[model samples]
Every structure is written in C-alpha cells, then in structure tokens.
Target chain A: MNDFIRNLASDLLRLEINTIIKQNMSAEKIPSNKRVLLRKLADMYRETLIDYGIAKSADDPQLTAADAPKVLRWQFGGEFSFKEIALMASKGIEQLEQAIKNETDPLRLNVLNSRQKILQRICNQSYNVIGIFKLFRRDLAPDTLMQSNEHEEPAKQIHYVDKEHFNYLRYQRGELPLECIPFRSHQETAHWNNDLDWMHLNAADDLPFLPDMLAMIYKAYQIGTEQIVLQTVIQVEGDITSYITPQYINMPDNIKEVVMNVHNRAISLSTQFWNTLFSTVMNLAGKSFNQIFTRNRK
Target chain B: MTLHSIALLWKKTVNWTFVPVKGLQFARSLLKNGGHVVETSFVFGKASFTFKTVISFGDIVVFIPDPAGYYAQHQWHDLCQNPHWHACYQKYLQIHFEEIANYFHAIERQIAFWQNSISGFIGIVNIYPLYRALLLGEWFLLFFPIASALYIRFLGKVTARAIALQLWQIAKKWFIPKAALIAKILPKAG
Candidate 1:
C-alpha cells in the first residue's frame, strides 16, 4: 500500500517542489496525473506548515524544567512521586533477595527468586510505564469491588469525563495536535446527556483511555465523509482497565481502504516524486538563496 | 578577583542548583601546580544564554529518566512517535479559546488551568484573599475601570457570564456533597 512518503531526505525536495508549484503554477505545463498527487501532497504540506507556525507562535509548554513533572501529573492524575516507585521496587527486591538467601527450602527459594525477577522487570521499565501501572490500579479505591455488586442495574454509567484530563484543554497553548472522535450513542455512559457530539483526543502513551494509535487515525479522519480513526464501538468500564496494555478495535475495510490507497499511491510515487523534485531543485540551485526562495514570498 | 566572587555570581544565576563536584573535580585537581596568582577581574568566561519556552502538548515525549548507561552526560531525546501520513488541517483552537476566555474575563478557565497545573494548586488553595478582592471587583474591575470597561465592551455577549464566574468558585467542596445528597434522596422517574 502506498502510504504517504515521510522520509526526511525528501523533505527539502518536497519544499522545493512546493515552491516550484506555487511560483510557476501553470497547470498546462505539468502532466494531469501527477498534478492530482502533488495537489494532495501540497495540502498535507500546508497543514504541516500551519502547525509549525502555531508551535512557533504559542507559549512554551514549560514555564520551567520544574514544571515538567507537574504536567505529567496533571495528565495522568497520579499523585505519587517518581522516587516512591523506585523505592517500592527496591524494597520488594531486597525482601525477596533476603528470603532467597536464607531459605533452605528449594520451592520457597524458587518462588522468592521469581518474585524478585518480576520486581526487577517492573523497576527496569521507564518512568511512564511504571506511572501508568500505578495510576490504573484498582487498589486505589477498596470499596469499588463492593460497590460494583451493590448496584443491581449496573453502576450509573454517567459520562465520567475525567475532570483532571479535561483540564489540559486550558493551559495548553501552542500546537497541541488533537483529534475529534464522534461518540456512538451506545458507547456513551448511561447518564451522559451532553450536547457534545465528539470527544477530543491527545496523542498519549500512558494509560490511554482512547487508542494510542489515535493520532495516526486523525490523518484519515475528516476525509470526505469518512473518518480514519478506528471505529472502536466498545469501551470497557473496567475496574483495572488498560492495566498491562490498552486494547484496540479494527476500522471497517472501506474506511481502512483510504489508508491503504493513499499508502500505495505514496509508495509508487517515491522514486519519481523525489527524482523530479530534486532535479527541479538542482536547476534552481545555481540561483541566489533569496531568488530561489523569493518566488512565493511576494 | 578572587574565585569567591565568581562562585557568588554563579550561585545567583543557578540558585538552588546542584553542585556536580565529581564532574568538575578533574579541572581543579588535575591542574597540579597550585600557585596563588592574584589577578583582577577580567572576563574569564563569557556566556550568552537565552531561554525560550516551547509548548509541546499532544506530542508523545517519553522520557527515559534513568538509563542504564551514560545517563550522566546529558539528557538524550529523540522524536518519540511516527508521523501521520495523510492530508490534515490542524487549526490551533487553543489560541482562539484563550482569546475568547481572556476577552470575556473568564478567569475560571485560568483558575481551572492553574489549579490543575504544576505548583498551581498551592497558589489556588490560598486564594481566599484573591477571591474576596475579585468578588468586590477591586483587582479586576473597580481599580482598573478602563481595562475592565474595554473587556466588557468587547465581550458584549459574554460579559454577564464573566461577572458570574468572577464571584464564584466552579467546584466548591460544600456544593458537591450537598448535590450528591439531593440526588440520592430525590425520587427518580426514569
């Protein structure tokens, strides 16, 4: 499938090609077949440029390096410090080691060593992974299990738009790449009665309430009448949700066809697009920098 | 000038900074010929540093805080995720959101942002005096009538909303439990 060509070596080539197209935009000069491809490519380039411009103009995400930790806290809604996770893991390992050292019993020693290995693995993973694990733990509220059974008709599935996560909409200045996912009526919470037709998605790795591949979907989203985002009809109201890994749903074939089709076209155009674009750039290379780039500036 | 003075200047710039003694130990210790060469202040080193904050939201930047090897040299960073490969338009809506919010004197959004943001909770928790002043329109309206008037005039439709939010907390602790109690006791017709 010809997905979009995203190689960095061709980035400059694309820019030069864009400049050539914009400056001497004579439709009659170019073949009609390539024009369609270039036109779509041009649109993508425009979006990238707009996003870059926004990023340049917006407030820096960090007020200070000190503020970085807090940003993660705000996103994930976990109140534990980084050291606590490390310390807890260390303590577990130490206890396990001591048990393994002292126990004359082979079976007990084997169990202790295995537990030690698990603790080591958890410790070895990166901060966000550990953070995600701790944040999504069911142990946060003991009464959750008890309460689940108490409700006969099932817990009131009011759209629990996590307030902490929602707050990110405010402080986020600059180019925050976001996507809108339209809610199916059935997927919504029971008491959810809001005028909002869509949910906003931020590309996140830890404890994804939405798909981690959500950002990738945004490209295909809003294409004609079809959406690129996965048509994930199911959202589990899980007690220990996304514990080890977040789950995903497959998009319909017709919708996914767009990605495949675009990918195939992009792949086919790879050599021809670059060779032509660079040849044009090389022709313009003899000119002064200002003259080469100035064509569209005016 | 003495090294003492230079150290003092360094402290002012990097206040509460770490003393990476081991990292820099070789520079002093390895310079074996120790001599008191009394010298006057001449620019030993000149550094021009400009700090700019770049906002990054929605981009996944996974920090490998403590790596197994060579973590001390400097923080290693790379573009964390694959780029999307489709024609997409990203209209930065936050800028518009901010313009509208500020124009309408909607401080609640700011308050929500601050309260949820880093070290922002501490400031908001001690906001009784600010709250009182805002309610009285001392800081926001009465004291700065011209600015206030312009804000109100520009936000003709949302001015009333602005005033309402200025007087109240969005989520008062007392209101939540009370609302919950009322909901539980009330008969439902669903």
Candidate 2:
C-alpha cells in the first residue's frame, strides 16, 4: 500500500511538471528574460524532485531544462495547468512591484497598484490550493515517513469486530448500529462496559473528537455483546452435553424431564427474541421519527 | 450489472447531487448571516471619503468606497486626483492597518480550526465505508452512499445554520467594538 501510494504521488508530480513545461513552451513569443525564469523554475523543480528521491542523479543528464519542454510537449501535449499559471502570476507580482517602485508618474502608479492587487488575489487563491494539496500529501504519506511531534499524543488503539458478529450482536439488542451509536455526548453508551462508562462520564468534561468517541462506543458494544452471547451459548451447550452421557441419562426420569424442559424454554425464548428484534427496532425508529415530526409541526 | 449494484450506483448518483445542493445552502447561510459590514467616513479638507468594509466569517475583508454617498462622490474623486489627501489618508490607514490585519488573522485562525473539525467529520463519514469495503470485504456497505447522503440531507442544514448563527454572534460581539473604535479615530479634515 505504501509503495502504491508513493508511486501514485510520484506519477502525479511528474505529470504536473510535464504539463507546466508544455504550457510554458506553447505560449507565443516568450521574452528572453521570461524564458530564463522558466528555465530557472524548471531547475528548481528538478532539484526538489531529487531531494524528495523522486528523481535520481543519473536521470539528470537526460532530463535537463533544455530537454524537458520538448519531451513534455511530445508526451503530454500543450495544455495550461493551474499551478504553472499561479507560479507565473507570483513572479509577475515581483516584476510589477519593481515597476511600481521605479515609476514616478501617479497615473502609471495607480494602474500598477491595481494590477498588483489583482495578482495578489490570484496568488492568495493559489496559496489556498497549494495548502490543500500539502494537506492531502501529508495524509497520503506512509506512517513510517510521517514525522512525529513531541507535543502530540499517539492515537489511541481502537478495537473492531467482524461484520457478521457486529450484525448478530446488534440484532440481539434489537437496534440498528446507527441507532445504537450515540450521536451526542449526553447520550448513554449502548452497551455497559467499565471503560465506556468512564469515557461517557468524562466525555462532557473534556471534548474528544466526535467520530472517534462514537467508533469506540460502537466497537465496545459489539465486543461486549458478542462475549456475553458466546458465553451463554457455551454454558448451555455444556449443560446439554453433560446430560447426554449414559450416567446422566440413567438419572430420575422426572428430574431429567425438568432439566430438559428448562433448557428447551431458554432456547425457545432466545429464538423468539431474535425473531422479533427487527420489527421491534423498526417500530421504535418509526415512533421516534413521528414524535419528532409532530412536535416540529406543533 | 446486478440489481443490487445498479441500486448502489443510483444511491451514489443521488449522493453526489446532494453534495452540491448542501454546499449551495451552506454558502447562502454564510453570505446572509456570517459577517458584519462596517462603514467609516473620513473628512479631509474639502473632500470626504466614506469607506465600507465587509468583514466575512471566513476572515476576508473587502474595503470599497461608497459609490452613492454625496460626500464620497463629489468631494473625493479617486484619491489620485488630490495627492495630499491621498497621502494623509494613506498615512492614517498605515497606522491602523497592522492592527486590522492582525484581528483578521486571529479570526482566520479560528475559522481554520473549525474548518479542520468539519472536514474531519466529513472524512470519517465518507472514508469509513471504503475502509470496511476494501479491508473487511463488507459487500453490504453498497448502501453506504445513500446512508451518508441521507445523513447529510437531514443534518447538513441544521449544522450550517447553527454555524452561521454562531459566526454572526461572534462578529457582533468582537468586530463591532473594533470597527466603532476605528470610526471614532477618524480625524476630521481641515
């Protein structure tokens, strides 16, 4: 997964760089000074790729600034890319600032100032896009590559259950996972566990991230409910198996009947509970929704 | 494709459509109630300039001259027309500019914090199903798109309104006094 992510990032970066080069080359009649600036920018990109281990030193000879534009144009075709435009706009601001400083005429100064303001707006928007991209890249970074901050605490370990088990337990409780999971801090945990109880008590005092808190509650419920059900099944199975032996079978017929009847009753009640669970949940949800809607209407 | 997959695809289509609808609603709320407009008038000799500054909940500040105001229209042409008044106004603006910028920066930081929180919530809702589908092989999550769409449709408006109201309250409490101070400091011209 890490390799796949890294490769995807590298491919995207290469594509972006190629598009930028192609776009720059396709522009009609670039001034000599602007050409020099583009070359310099290309060099900067090359160095950045090398620093990030996306490009190797051996590839430098084939991928020089002079060769990049032609290769990129042939491969990706000539198209405008947003990052390239933003980069040029930023550089244009620098030139505009210099012109504004050098000009003595008030009218020209006003024009230059307006142009600079417009360019500044574009640059600000570009910065926002760049910031979002940076955030995305950081999220995609492999765990090993991610820098750890001393002040930041390590994330808490979360428990998860298989879908089948989660569904079974939820069915037994006569609730949808959505309904079972508490949306607000004030709501009680669906299933009782010491850790969840403590967490719920403290939830109001110290605000944790909402999704994490809910996930923890859900998982704890699933695990707790599954354990209780499995334990009950095991105990029932043990009792039935113990009675199946010859010595146990030889016991008083009345006592044996009573024991079997008690076991049968427990099994019948469990079966009935599971059968009614879905309908019960639906009815409860309908009632709640109706109440909310009626109250709103009033 | 199977009926199940087709149903899932339709849900996803509805979800994608709903996202932009909710986005537009949120934008409308933000525009309506998430900011305060501050107007200040500056008198300089024979010329007076009225500046209207709109400070948005997103911490964007826009300053514009009042195009319709009598003093602003007749007295102050473009600042370029009278360099002396322009220079004086510039000097005055320079003095308070840093403070205003800092105030907006603080507001921006607060907005960014809230943006992170909102995005975090969205990330969980959108990504959780994918994680389950890919890692746990949970085919039942085909309904996730519709579920999330329903979640957003029902809850998105309430959240947007609440946030907008909160922003309005904050702007009223914090920005009004600061704007009033700036208006009070406007030196009379002449």
Candidate 3:
C-alpha cells in the first residue's frame, strides 16, 4: 500500500516538474539552451512511455525537427497548450507557496487546499488513462514477473473465441502463426505492472500518431490474422468448422461493430483473395466427391 | 446404349456382389477407382428389392436402375404426377432436410474433436515450456497449414456423405415408390 502511494506521488511530482519547466521556459522567462534541454527531457519521457505500451491512442513516432513548431498539451481534448498549462500550473503552485508564506490566515489555508484540489482534478482529467499493463510472453520466461489484481472487469472483453475464428481463417489460408501482443490486463494470473513507465504511456494526453498508427496496425491484418488464427487453433477446441466457417458470426452489437471496423479495413487487401481461395478449395472438394460417384458405375 | 439396356447391364453387373451389413449402419458404399457403387435395400411383399447403385459422380447420373422395376421404374414420374403422392413426396424431401441438419451437427462433432486434440497438445506444451521450445521450433509453422488442409480434406469426407445422401434421396424416388417407394425403404418394420 505504501509503495503504491509513494509511487503515485512520485509520478505526479514528475509530471508537475515537467509541466512547470515547460511553462517557465516559454510563457515565462528561461534561457534558450535550458529550454532545449527541458524539451529533450520531455521528449525522452514520452518516448519511454511509448516503449512501455502505455502511450495514448493518438501517439505516433515523432516527426523530424523540420515539422512545424513544437506543441504539447495535457490531454488530447484539452484546449490549452503546454505553455498555457504551464502558466496555469505556475499560478496554482505559487498560490500554495504564497499561502505557506503567510502561514497564519485560515482563509489563505482554505485557498491553498482548494487550489491543490483543483490541480489534482486537472491532472486526473488530463492524464488519467490508468491502471495495469498486462504482459503474456509466449516464451513464458521466468523473468517476466507480474503482480495479480483480482478486481475490475473491463466493460468490453476480447474473447478467445473471436481470436479462434480469426486464427482459424488464417490457418486455412496457409498462413503463419501470430505474434503475441501485450495487453492491459490478464484476469487469470491477475499479474500486472503499473510502474511509472507504464503509467506515463497510459496517461499520454495527446496522441498525434492516431491515424498513421492505426493504418500501420491495419496493414498487419494479413500477417497478424495468420498468427491470430494459428494461436486460436492452438488454444481452442470444438466446432472446428464454425471456428473459421466462412459464414458471418453473430456477435453482440458492440463487439460486432469493432469486428466490422477491423474487417472493413482489411477487406481491400484480403477479402477477395480469401473468398477465391475458399471457393477453390470447396470446388475441388466437390469435384473429388463427384468423381468418386461417377467413375465407379461403369 | 439406350437407358433400358444400360439399366439391364447395371442390374446384372451388381447381382453377384454382397457385402456384410455390419458396422455400416449409417451407410454402405463401395468406393471404387474412377467412381463408386452404393448399396441400397428394401422389402416389398416378402420379396426384398436390393440393388447396387453404380454412381458416376462426374456424370451426376446416380444409377441406371431396372426400368421395369414396378414400384420405381416408370412409377416415379407417375408418382410425381400423382396428387396423393404430393404429401408423401414432400414428406420424403423433409427427411432429406433433416439429414442435412444432422450432417451439420456431425460436423460440429468433428470440430470439437479437433479442438480438444489441439488444446490438449497445447496445454502440455504450455505447462512444460521446454516442450514448446522444441515443438514450436522454426519448421513448426509448416505444420499449421498441413493440419488445416488435412482437416479440410477430412471435412471433405464428411461432406461427401451429405452430398451422397442428397443424391441417394433423389435416386430413391425411382426405387422407392412415392406410395410404394417411400413405403419400401427406411423400413418401418421387419
């Protein structure tokens, strides 16, 4: 418990310091060289978040320095720029500091407390995509130590059944196995890590790479499907026909929508090719059966 | 040759052949190179009408049954033309549909079998981890397509049964009378 609280406090402190440095450098007065150093540190921190798989959905690989002026915001939706946030944070911090200076007036004390509360809420709103980075290494290496958390069921579940179907489709197409993906939760082992690294990635405010990143993800559909199919085939049992049956499966509306989105993206690259392949296989089968019947009569 | 001569030769060719009726409860077929011969039987008034179906899958010609065979023979076209036989014919078609549903169910069983086998193997691989390393080595990726293809071919066999059943139903109208054919086979009594 103490570890969790301490870890959380440290994380908030780091975020605050990052925000303050940015504010002091641009909106306020700080040396140009010092500003460059602060920017580098901030970029490094963001890179670390991306590596940890805790980065916001919109994050992308940073462009070259030639790409326009630098802009950082606390949240994707937050209207204020990093400089604006710095200015706000600076004022808030100073209010608390000023209240400490007097150290006597009850009204000042109330103001300090209220100011802190406001900053905390703003922080939560800006960077609050929180909790756990689930890792299931296929290697199941002993070094991959994870802590289990029992509670909290995500509202939308990604069932192995769906993957089984997806993977089966891949398998039928003579595709290779899928690569393993790390997720944000593992209910069975309840093992997880929300350390500062994961926390930073998850709480990313601006995801500039959303469109490009999603395109890359979609591009993997052809190959990744093979893996999903192979993995599912390896994991699931029964209803093998329906496992990758050509027919559309009925799913809950929410899940169906998600599947449609992924499927729609891959249709251009995959649908016709697969359809032709399956039909060819089926037609060959039909002919084989046909030959068996006709050739024996004579 | 005419259909009549063809039917006569078909009947003569199959008369000498007999197969044990055991272990073939669901079906009795003689799969031959180039084609197959399916056996069917029924009783009419103490005389059993047993026939060998010379099936030409390529030709879509089920068999050339004896054209003079009374219950079937020329009786089939008449039966179809018969209004009384409508209900019976429809009922027989209904039976075909039921069997199709059953075929799909059997396919479900086939899928379950594969899943259980694969999962069991995977479970072992997971627990031992060392086995996974050996089993999941570089060339291991090749096994998936082979396994899946084998599965498809096996499904092909299952589907063959279904397709054969459908053909059998169509050919049945000839041997089994609408009033007489339906009564002759799928025998209700000894």
- Taking all chains together, each candidate's TM-score versus the true structure is 0.15, 0.21, 0.16
Q: After superposition, how far is residue A269 of candidate 2 from its true place, in Å?
A: 65
Alpha-carbon runs more than 4 Å astray in model 1: A1-82, A126-298, B1-190
Cα miss at A238, model 1 (Å)? 42
Question: In CAPRI terms, where does candidate 1 land?
Answer: incorrect
Position B15, candidate 1: lDDT: 41
Tens digits of per-residue lDDT for model 2, A169-258:
543565432212111221221121111222343332322112222222222211111101001222212332121433224434543443
Show pairs that collide, candidate 2.
none
Evaluated against the true structure, the overall lDDT of model 1 is 0.28
lDDT of 1 by residue, A204-257 (tens): 222221122122122111121111121111111222111110111232343234
Question: Candidate 2 DockQ category?
Answer: incorrect
TM-score ranking from best candidate downward: 2, 3, 1
Poorest 10 consecutive residues of model 2 chain B by lDDT?
Answer: B58-67
State in Å the error of residue A256, model 1.
39
